[model samples]
Target chain A: MKRTNEFAVGLAVLLALTVVVAGALWLSETDLNKQQVTAQARFRTVGGLGVGAPVTLRGVKVGRVEAIRLVANEWVETEFSLDRVVELPPKPAVISASASLFGEWSANIISYDPPPTDPNLREALAESDQVGGDAWPGATLPDIGQLTAQASRIAGDVGVVTQRISQAFDSTALKNMQQSVKDLAEISGRLVEFAGAQTTRIDRVSRNVATTSDAFAGVAQTFQGAVARLDTATSDNQLKDILNNGRASSADLRQAAGDLRSVMTAARENQASLIRVVQQADSLMTKIQRGNGTLGMLASDSTLYRETTATVIQFRELLTDIKANPKKYLKISVF
Target chain B: MSPPVASRIAARDGFVAHIGRRSLETARALADVRTWSPLLMGQMRRLGVDSVPIALFIAVFTGIVLSLLSSYIFTGAVPLYFVGALVGKTVMMELGPVLTGMALAGRVGASIAAELGTMKVTEQVDALETLAYDRNAYLVVPRVLAATLMFPVVTALAMGVGITSGWITAVNLLDLSTPEFFKGLKLFYQFKDIWFGLLKSASFGAAVALMGCLRGLDAKSGAQGVGQSTTRAVVLGCEAILVLDAFWALVLL
Candidate 1:
């Protein structure tokens, strides 16, 4: 009975211990039952990633880092055991130590297409003892430190630009700009006044021009009347009549000039005859001076002059008698 | 010096000497593996198999409370499934083993101390020594060996119960799906977490048994001494477990 009791007790303890161990294993969730593939990757830096960190494919957990060690004192060689169910792309790329929301780091495969079916590539991959290329480092969300530094730099640049703008708008430049605007306004005001004066002058000149145009119109009307009169004279034969009258006047003038020339000739002949008579008279006067002519002798001899006077008285008496008796003294001969 | 002060100093010195002697005795007892092997089975049955019910109870309640609190606290910012991770981590790394050790300290430590104290007070221990039997090898070694060997088993059981209860609470009460709860449970779990818990539990078990035995051996004559020894065993065992837990955390983590 004692042995049986002891045996039962032993069995119970064994069973409880087994249960405890099995429970621990279950809680741990070790991949002891599942098949896993060992893959290796090399990195320059692991970025605080350690063994047992989750290996994810596009944010889904697919494996875990089994080991990490430095190789050749330069690169970190990480060996991970991925579940066989996860199919890796032919060129699967990984990002090392991507930061999570809670600041924990994880290894993530950014691309996860199926492996190439090419046998040559598969053989090469196998021979090289590599699954894919090195994972891109720092491919996670932007680091807070980097963002802060960039923000600070941008803020500094903005400050510099603001300062430059403030400096550019100093009092001197502001005053110059204000003066330029004022000058422009004053010049515009002067131009407006000048334009007004010019407009008044132009109006006066326009009125003068109108007056001149009216006078020119009168002159043009007179010229038109003169041209019409001249055209009438030319077209109506009045000019021909005037021309005939002018010719007749010229003929009459020529006839009068001939008559005048004949009269002058007759006058010239009379003048010669008169000149002969005058010469005979001049000779008789010379004889009288020398007591030649009767009148001259009478003037020169007083006695002769008395006798002639008596004779003239007799002649007078005779002429009176003839006048009283006309037929008496006159000779009537028709022959 | 005052009487009270002198007595206090003397007590402290005696405690130091007792601890040193206990350690020496334990080391010496470890050399007698052949004699201790036969007694380990009975002690293991008592320490491990007998303690499962209370350990499970504590563990189950711990899991439910952890799940409820974590769900409440991390509902919005964290995913609902993280409740399982929280419970698993707590049970495996801290609560399951530590709570089980404390329970055992109260249950097994008190009993061992009372039994040994009674034997000491009644002169049974002296009789065994007079009979040329090695008392430490026969009594202390078996108890320490049994407790150290069995504590991990109890801790593992506690861990299982705690995780299961946490899973149930998370899925049913917290509205987390079964798959999500399980994913979170296994999300951050590692083999080292279980190993570390078992190692700490083993150390705690040894400490509890050793302290109980030491206190009982040092008991005064009478019923009062037996009671005092029993109380001291539980108290010191609990203290040792916490201290060792902190030490292991510092060294391992």
Candidate 2:
């Protein structure tokens, strides 16, 4: 009986010790991070998001996802909790990303710059914990989804703009450009010689401007006196009839004045655009004059110019040969 | 017959003989198990109550040593608590059960074989048969059943002691933070492991008991016969325990 009692006591002691040790361990782990607020963020596609996913703000971990579940409509939602002090910034952008491609996907949050324009909109959004309010036009987020969306939008816009550009520079435009280039080449080939003998041409341009100004002054003076004539003729029958008949001339003068004003307005509106084009043209002309770069060298260098001409001549001959000897060049092999 | 055919015939006969002896051994074990079941309750008390202090010391010291040494070895790679959990699991699930069976077999298997061998030489077994009682029942059932039932309880005791020893060792020798160790062990360990060890222990008990009783029954004539039976009981019992352990590992683990 004594031996049995002793053995039982020993067994009981061991059992109790084990239970106490195991129970204490269990309790410590249970109490760890208890009562923390677990918030879930639902998304259409988590993509690669998983449990134990880190929630980061500007590359700093704010919290971690504890669990993941598929909600209604097969959208995956992540359950996560954050520290008490981690106040979410306004216009928080959540994006799924990875430290590396093969690594786990973490939800990164980036905050917007402080703008007084967005808070009132955000205040309306604060009512629903599920999703925040409307995206402020001034407020922008850089979430991974937003980045992907932006990239796609940019690509689409580029594609559309490219199409528009292609349409704008159509076949007609290309033909016109080719004609213009031919005219320019002819003019440039002669310009060197013309520059050495352009004293007469310079004088002629100034003389034309002078003559046109003179004509305008003469017309203004004539019209001013003509109005006096009309005033006196209004009392006489023949003169009044002539005045009525001469209304076309007065209308023509008014039309000329209107045209001048419209032209001035158009010039004013196009001043900056005209300046930009002029600057680009001037730079191009300067490059041509200095004989720098491809275009300058192409125009000035005789060797390249001869090669190009020869190449075009050869291309013409090749095309002629293909057309003439159709059997040899365009033969279809049965095998 | 040709040499090849003759050898093949001999090999087949040897194989048949091996199969026959193994079948006999299995039949005897089945009979012994049936006897042990009726006397299980009576046997459990004797084995568990008889061996306590040694079981306690060995289990406690073994756990402590494992916990301390493993803490040093695994501290860099894993959390100390996980190490503690591994120690707990290893002790409770395997070491506790197997060690308890070995200890009991050494204590009880040799005794059964030696006692019966001596009684056979002294003609006590014959005398019992003359009184119209079953020798196998009275002699074998009580000791074999006691060892079998005791095996599991002793294992349970060892498992409990081993876990507690690891805790104490983690605190004192490994200098693991008490709370951290507890938390780590808690997170890593499952309750199911303890039950798995208990099951292994019961199986081991049956194996040890059956081997001991069978060897004793097969004892021959003279002092050398007694010695041979004793030696066979231990060697075969230990070997069978290892083989059964491997088989169970494949099946259960």
Candidate 3:
């Protein structure tokens, strides 16, 4: 064999071996020189996350998941190796989420201080915090496929609701709604008219109130003046002299009241005679009203009124003749 | 005994005797490794090193076609970066080994069978036996050992070229960036995938060389027999490669 062939064959084998080793290390992102720190994360679910999934800090790749195992059939614990130079944020949290729409997943190391903006992510993180251990708190975001399925379900629900709405909103319901609207419009017109009438009445009432308030203010002023006068009367010594005079007048009025009481007693004793006289007068008045006695006949007889009126007129004429004739006969004697 | 029964029993005994002879040859080859050891490097050079160019040629086009095809298939349904994933995975896991093995079967297996068959038909193998030379050690062990040892090296180089070609196609033709292509390439890569492919290629190499040896040693008559053995070696080696590919996928993967 030629030395050149041996060299070529050895070189080819060496080159192939180097490619295999170097390609694996580069693709796996494993550095033999770099020191690594191992950390464990406990999760309720890993979703599409698997071994060799990239671990990122602040969106930059820092490590990869080394192994995953189920613990007590409850939690999925993922052991990962991080570059030792990476300084973990205080209160580090792990959120495993779909890295792309193609079912790729990644673990994002985040700080719990700022918290996640999404309420669901926040709740998941809170639940993970309760999984007490040295392991970092880990939460799994719903995969893109799950989100798509949920959106599809929501669309189905909306479609069903829309179909039901279309079924219920038939011609009859439309007519009923139109009738209600018409009735509402008519009621609104009537209310407007009623309000117009009430508005005038309200204006009148407001004017009356204004007048009453003015009157009440005057009365209040008068009362205030009276109160002031009363206060002055009470303060002055002249009010004491008036009170003394009032006392003396009260005694005189008391004596007069005693006399009045005696008179009332005497009147009480003559009450029967007085009542008999009142009854006789009442009888006379009743006869006159009934036109039954002589006074009643005179009141009722129109011919007697006429005859008396004629006799008075004739007597006036005779008196006039006597005056003239006596003057002529010189009958001016004191007979 | 009936004549048909006698013939059936005779066929069965002949098959068993063939199996016994093949076993003895394999045992002799192993026992006399020193006698065949020197021929191993020359065989490796001819079989593995010389075979690298053709394997790499097949791998490059396989990568380019796979990249373009995956881009077409995953156009809107999946991200463009997944083209890289498809190209990398298919080349490393299946195409790189299987295609390289088939190409080598046509090249190395046919040549081995033709050369050995010509020797057998010309009484060169008989002359060796008459001279008390162990032909299995002198001929079969070295070829099989060289093929087995070198198939992985060639496969590894082909895998590297295949991935590189895919990356170039993605960057140039698919409008994908280097980082984007590499992102998807590393997405699902496992170190064991390389080992699995190498193991399958090694098995294919052994099967192809062994089948060629068996067919060549069994050749009869003259030039026509040599041609027939060469054809059988190429056909049987290809079939063996496909069967081994499936077998490795099931057993290891």
Candidate 4:
């Protein structure tokens, strides 16, 4: 009975221990039988990566970090184990440390397509071959410290730009722009008013031009009618008679003009003789008035003239008698 | 000084001497492992195998509470599945081993101290010494070995139960799926975390058992002494677990 009790207790304890250990192994995700391929990568810094950190392919975990060591006291050599079933390209890009959104860090693998062509990539690939054929050069993300520094620099640049912009928009420049806009608006208003006022004057000028053009058209019509009449008269033989009459009239007029010219010449010749005769007449009239001529004296001596007349009457009687007898006497003397 | 004060000071001195002597005797008992192996197995059955139900109950409820609180606190910024990771990490790294150690300190430590203290006060331990048997090896070593062996098992059990309960609660209440919960649970977990927990639990188990034995061995010949010893064992066992937990964290982590 005592042995049976001891056996039962031993069995129970063994069972409990086994259960506990198995549960722990399960919770810890231990898989001893999983096949792993060892690969190496080198970096300038590991960025706080420790052993047992996950190794992922495109953000999915496939293995863990096995070891890390310094190479030649300069480069960090990180050895990681990956599942053998996960195939890597001939050249793979390894990220030494990548942080998740929650800040957990891990190593990641990215496949290099078309094989890297850069010289640095070739050198890294060659170095990876020295550790293992599956190895590659690892890359690193900018850490929080670097990101914070970059952010601070960006913020400083933004602040400076804002300050410069603020300075550029000074009160004077803004006011000048506003004033220029207002001046343009006023000029536009004046131009509109000028155009409105000129419209009425333009209408009046157009009406006057229309009226003058109508008068000119009427004058042109009248001149055209006269020209038409003249043209019709020239086209007919009616102007020939008038032209002939004009020529005849011109000849007669020339003859008449010649006669009149002769008459005028004769008159001009007789003008001097007429002036002499008139002067003689004027002297006799003057002498007569002064009573110096014989005729003038005869009139003045009318009474004495009567007596002489009586004597002459007596001589006449005597001459009448002598004449009857004097012919015979004078005839004989002349022979 | 008054006479009563002088008496109190003398009493204090004597109690200090008694604790020191008991500690030395317990250290000497560690050398006799062969004689205590069978008793260690029996005690292991009692401490670990038999105590699974209560430990599981406490762990499950603790996990539920941790999940509830984490979801409530981190709901806005953190994803819902992170509650699983939070609960798993907390239970495995700190709570699982420490809480289990404390629970056992109350249950197993008080029981051991009360049994041994009653024996001491009744002169049963003296009778065993007079019979030419090694009382320390027969009595205290088994309890210490059993507790040390069982602590890792119990801690592992608690961790598994607690993490599972947290996963269940997150799935049911926080709208998290099973796969997402599991993904978050294993996001940053490591085998070293389990090892650290086991190591601390082993130390805590040994401390709890040793303190109980020492207190019982130093008990006076009265019912009051037995009761006082039991109380002191539970209190000192819990204190020792906390101190050792901090020490291991400092050294390992």
Candidate 5:
């Protein structure tokens, strides 16, 4: 073989070897020159994260995963290397998530001060922390497939809810709602009409009140004049004398009222007797009307009344005869 | 036994005998590394170093096409950076080794078979045998050893070129930046990916070179046989590559 050929072969082999080794190192982010800080995190799952998976801090590539192992049948502990320059937060936590729709995954180092917005992730972090290790807390974010499945389930639930709503708001419900609206409209119309009537009545009442107010004004004026006159009378000594007389008269009236009250008390006491007497009177009057007694015969018998009238007329005639022939009737005059 | 059964059994025996002979030849050739060691560099220069351009040619286009294709497939379904991932992974894991192997199989396998077959048909191999020369050592060992040693080197170069081509295409043709493409490229990268690919290519190299040598040794019918051996070597080499690729994946990955 020519020396050139051997040289070419050697060069190619050397270059190819370099490429393989260097490519692996570069892609793996195995920086031997720079210092790396090894840290660990425990997760319930790694979500397809494997060795050499990039470890990022706030979306910035900080390091790569070195190893992952299941510890104690409960959690997966991942040991990763971060650039020595990386300044970890006060409470650094790790979240493993599908880097893309593809099966790729990455671990993101974050602060645990503000917990993750996702409830499941927060709970996973809490659980990891509760495991009580020096390892940073870690949680697995759901992959695309899991999220898609959950979305499908949520869509199904929404579809069911929509179907139920459609069923509930059927034609019958629509008609009933329409009827209720119509009744409301009708009631509103009646209320409007009633309000109009009340408005008119109020206007009429206002006019009546205006007239009454005018009449009251006149009455007030007359009352004011009377008050003035009263004021004038109050200032006069004659008014005082009148007041004195009025007081005396009021006292007399009071005494009279007291006497009247005594009479009334006596009358109230004899009320039964008075009622009896009245009843006897009524009976007597009834007897008189029936001509059962002398007074009653006098009151009711025309024959007795005519007989008395005739006796009086005969006496009168006898007196006239005695005057003409006195001896005939005067014989018994002295007895 | 009936005549047909007897003939089938006879054919089976012949086949078994052929396999044994080929196995023996391969074993002897591999064992005679000392004899072939001086010739190894020349063969390496011819088979591995010479084949770099072609392997890289295949890999560049493969990477370019994969980038475009992955971009198309993963357009809205995933982030565009995943185009870098798909290109890197496909090239490193599958296309880089397989394509480089198959290309070298066509180039180097046919070359070996044609050269050796021509020599066999021209009685050069017999002449060597008559001179007490180990034909397997002279003919097979150096070629197989060179191929085995250098196929990985060629594949490694090809993988690098392939990924570089993909990165270029993504940055130029696709809406991707250097960091983004690299981020995706490194995202799913594993050291085992390179190891497995190199291992697979090494197996491919050995198979292709061995098949060519075995076919060349078994050549007949002169010029026609040489052509036939060349064709068969290329065909069988490709088939072996595929089968071995699958085997490695199943076993290693």
Candidate 6:
């Protein structure tokens, strides 16, 4: 090719590329197919909307931003093009989420399941087969920005709470709390004594939890198999639960993870009880070390001590009382 | 003969010289824009309007990929409304501007840099100066003004398209309701967002254009210098856009 021609060809290619991009953009925005079904969504507040922002469902490319209007003081109307085949769930959980942290705003239609529950599987027809515009909302939503922000806010509060808890643990003289700990120790000692006879009950509860864990593990194995099958289904996409397929397996795994986390949290909450149990065990060990009780003496001492100096002290106390008030103490009283 | 006085005097002289040169450049660019408003109309037709298809393809894929990525991790506290909103907000407020600016900078800005660099290496700039013509006004301003004007328009279009692509994914692949999807958009977005988005794009466009023009005008040495200027223009253009985008997002968005 001639030099000028080559340059011209390069420019032409670039130009063609741009034209194609623009045309494709226009088509996507307009939803050039079907042309009907005026897809509209109502917002409590349309923050900084113009007539030409894109409307999306679940972060996918669907249609263009046709227009936005203020219907009333409190309500705003946003109209856009939507491919007719894509069903909109009734009462779908809609939120302002972006595909990118810093990008255009799009509408995510969560769960998009239709009303009148329990559609037969073989009979589950497409919305195009019936009237469009409503379905069941998707699974539990993660509040993207709002959750992160609120989590951050909650984290700050938690930091304060955590510091206060640490301080409560650290607080000494001014707290009037050392006495409380002493009282707690006494109460705990009493509780150990009380539960001493109830070892059988604690054992039973532990056994029950074990049974439940085993049963849960069996169910979990089934879940893992189901997930493995799903992993195959998802294929190279490596879906990994991000897509939220609304399948039972996904729900099971999610719930199981949640349940497991909760169980761990509960265990953490009882950390003090666990520690006390360990401390009580150490005390029992110490008493045995000193040969102070039946177990301790049995472990160390061969003979039991009979009445000795301590017995004489009791006899002396009785005699001293007798001398202090003979009439009352001896009961002679001139009778 | 204290060193402090001499240093102060030199600093003042340098500042004055810098200001004088910059002002002269600015004046030349302004004059160029005035002289070649008509040519710009043609160049834009060839350059700006020409880049449509690839932009659309990119925009669509961007939406899809972003959607795939955005909901990568979900904490079940808040509902998924903001997942959609994240896509919207990022595309509208940040990525749309940044990507569009960078694309234009790489595609359009580098060309301006190379053209100006070549003119300088060959002393065409000096010839123009000798003819009592300001090179900035004749060569730099039209490209700057076109880019400053055209880029934001492209970005807005890209935003519009990106959201559309996101919708397709949401409806078909993600299986979200179209109505609820739009509802999230309606609820979250406002007019200020659009204004801020455009403002950022315009500023970014101007920065990239200016950087490209400056590098081209200031080119030294041979072919290596022209290549260096082009590369520097692209890098500086992108950097300036990003920094300015962040600043504008903070101040305006």
Share of native interface contacts recovered by each model: 0.48, 0.04, 0.74, 0.32, 0.96, 0.00
Which of 1 and 3 is ahead in DockQ?
3
Looking at candidate 1, what is the lDDT of residue A37? Answer: 80
In candidate 1, stretches whose alpha carbon ends up further than 4 angstroms from where it belongs are A1-34, A97-99, A111-335, B1-10
Cα interface RMSD of each candidate: 2.9, 6.5, 1.1, 3.0, 1.1, 8.7
Q: Report the TM-score of candidate 5, chain A only.
A: 0.48
lDDT of 3 by residue, B178-209 (tens): 98999889888888778888898999998888
Candidate 2: how large is its RMSD? 37.8
| Residue B228 error, candidate 6, Å | 0.9
Q: Candidate 6 residues A238-269, lDDT tens each?
A: 57455656576788999999999999999998
- Would you give the TM-score of chain B in model 6? 0.85
Local accuracy of candidate 5 as per-residue lDDT tens digits, B1-253: 8999999999979956985787688677777767788888899999999999999999999989999999999888899988888888899889999999999999999999999999999999999999977998988888988999999999999999999999999999999999999978887778888888899999999999988988888789989999999999999899989999999988997
Q: Stretches of candidate 5 above 4 Å error? A: A99-104, A113-122, A154-335, B1-17
Cα RMSD (angstroms) for every candidate in the order listed: 33.2, 37.8, 23.9, 31.7, 22.2, 36.4
Candidate 5 lDDT tens digits, A1-335: 57988899989989998998888878887868869889999998898899988889989988889999999958899999999988999999999988776687889999999988889889999999988878999998889998899999999999999999999999999999999999999999999999987998899999999999999999999999999898898888768999899999999999999999999999998998999999999999999998888988788778987998999999999889989997775675555
TM-score for each candidate, following the candidate numbering: 0.62, 0.44, 0.65, 0.64, 0.67, 0.44
TM-score, candidate 2, chain B alone:
0.80
User: In model 6, what lDDT does residue B172 have?
Assistant: 76
The TM-score, computed over Cα atoms with residue i paired to residue i, of candidate 1 is: 0.62
lDDT of 1 by residue, B43-131 (tens): 87787778888999999999999999999999789877778778988988999889999999999999899989999999999998999
Grade the docking of candidate 4. Answer: incorrect
- What CAPRI class is candidate 1? acceptable
True contacts kept of 1: 0.48
Residue B28 local lDDT, model 5: 70
lDDT of 6 by residue, B1-253 (tens): 6799999999879855854585467656675555667556544543354544555666787888776666554335434454566677777777777777778778777888898899999999999889987676677666677677666667777777888788778777764677756655554555556657768888887888778888888789979999999998899888888899779867764
Residue-wise C-alpha lDDT for candidate 2, range A201-272, written one tens digit per residue: 888988998999999999988998898787677656768677777897899989999999999999998998
Model 6 interface CAPRI class: incorrect
The C-alpha lDDT values of all candidates are 0.81, 0.67, 0.89, 0.81, 0.90, 0.66
Task: Count backbone overlaps in model 6.
Answer: 86
TM-score of the A-chain for all models: 0.36, 0.31, 0.48, 0.41, 0.48, 0.33
lDDT of 4 by residue, B11-82 (tens): 989967876776677678778777676677678777766666777888999899999999898888888778
Residue pairs that clash (backbone atoms under 3 angstroms), model 3: none
